[model samples]
Target: MTNKPMVSIVCTSYNHGDYIAEAIDSFLMQKTNFEFEILIYDDASTDQSPRVIKQYENNYPSLIKPIYQTQNQYSKGVRVEMFNHNRASGKYIAVCEGDDYWTDPYKLQKQVDYMERHPACSMTVHAADRVLSDKKKVLSRVRPEERNAIFSVERVIEGGGDLIATNSMVYSKEKVKVLAPFYLNAVVGDYPLVILAALHGTVDYLDENMSAYRVGVKGSWTERELATSLKRINHYHDMEKMFDEINEYTEYRYNSALEKAKLGYRFSLLLEQGRFREAKHGEYRKIYLELGAKKRVLLEMKRYFPNVTESIRKARWKLIH
Candidate 1:
């Protein structure tokens, strides 16, 4: 079909040596008649990731184009580089990280065809099954409507529902040109990308599960500690600040920050109520401060008053003894 559309698949790889091959294989497995190209940026991985990527590049010279870096760049910076280096002469662009894989052969085709037909659509994302690293287990599945029946800006701010995991997303290049700046302009990239894309027009939601999202790997951004969470919260705050700087009248910034703040308050409440087996509140409060949320401060202090009073009692008992 000479008239068929072309889509560019953009994948970023780090040190995913254990699962890089599968990631590359997923793209090559697409059985679409339409022309498509794969762009893989290997961010100077330390392990066998570059080697694995090269193997695929050599194997599929026509379909896969690999950009193996000589030095390592962190995920935050690497993704912005992905947008800058990406030159897709296609109507649409798709994304899949090195750890994630497409389970369906028609994943790209299905989304591409839908977006092409619907001119008002700026992007499309499908549900994904979350796969844990150990036992290669499927932990849970998420869809957009699961978090929100209506894809409004408020639901997005609340951070609920079927979000576009890197692998499960396909976007229009025209929309990309407009939205990529907004996404890259922020330290927290993914959410802003979706927000800006949603602003352009309606997003096509595919109810079908399309990809597998892998978690619990070393050096993965998802594997954040308290320090990392604090840093990320700071970055997320910077992103929200940028949102306000650009769109001052838009209340989504406050709503998003408030959502993060509410999460902090809830986690602190969990800790205060002695829910130690499950909840962690140390870092959530850091996010609350980062978001500049004043409303939750009183609630947070109230949650910690009992612990503070207990500590004082223990000190007094020690002195008396």
Candidate 2:
């Protein structure tokens, strides 16, 4: 690992002390022909996360570079992962969070070889195991496609965040720089980054499951934003504005697909907020029709007995979290 790094591995840590060692060890274990540097940004973690990072930095000073933030940047509206991109001195950027670990030792080796051969591909992502964070139970999941393929911009806009996992992302540094300014203000960074990167060039899909996605983790965007009623309303609004920005950026070329994605988010918001009438009619009716018969019936039940539904929802959240 003495030569200049061909890839920069980006990671963020916030109270992930328990899992940071696995993540760091995973990065160190990658068997790549070309050297790669790990850039970990510690968001002033009020936990043992920083200590783990320091130990790794000491052991591999040349490879493990980190920033110990004195203040939390995300709370100040900073798109936190950009910390790695800004300091990136490599041709490609790869991402893995402190709570997520790569399973394959040859992951970087395999991806970089493919990207080196295909200049047309700005990014490449693989399938990953989506596991319950606390239980460590692997949920049956499939993503992108069943085989290797080219992921297009339209497909990216339509699928949003579900199509790609951040831990599985490896993209050209040059392509991402052009998109940074456009998505800097967006509430969520990774989703828009994928969309904008797809606009630059194709995204190669690798069928291999190379990483683990720890779902329902503490301080995760899903838990902090999408798991509640009030937060989800604002979250959906953020989603709406992001779609509008992308549509305009693409000159309405992908308006049809993007509109459908936005409508789904709107439907989710209305249903969760007990606005049954809005969710069952108008633009949302399309999603209602698309749902299975059982789900439609359940939605009616929840609509009529909102108090019961609310109680049930609260119980579920408490049980899970």
| Candidate closest to the true structure, highest lDDT | 2
Q: Indicate the TM-score of model 1.
A: 0.73
What tens digits encode model 1's per-residue C-alpha lDDT throughout 26-125?
8888988788888888778889998888888888888778777776665345554454235666778887878888899999889888887888888788
- Model 2 lDDT, full chain set: 0.86
RMSD of each: 9.1, 2.0
lDDT of 2 by residue, 70-166 (tens): 8999888887887888998889999988999999999999999999999988999999988877676897554769889898787888777878888
Local error of candidate 2 at residue 275 (angstroms): 2.3
lDDT of each: 0.67, 0.86
Q: Among all windows of ten consecutive residues in candidate 2, which has the lowest summed lDDT?
A: 176-185
Cα deviation of 272 in candidate 1 (Å)?
12
Question: Candidate 2 clashing pairs?
Answer: none
| TM match of model 2 to true structure | 0.93
Model 1 error, position 249 (Å): 8.5
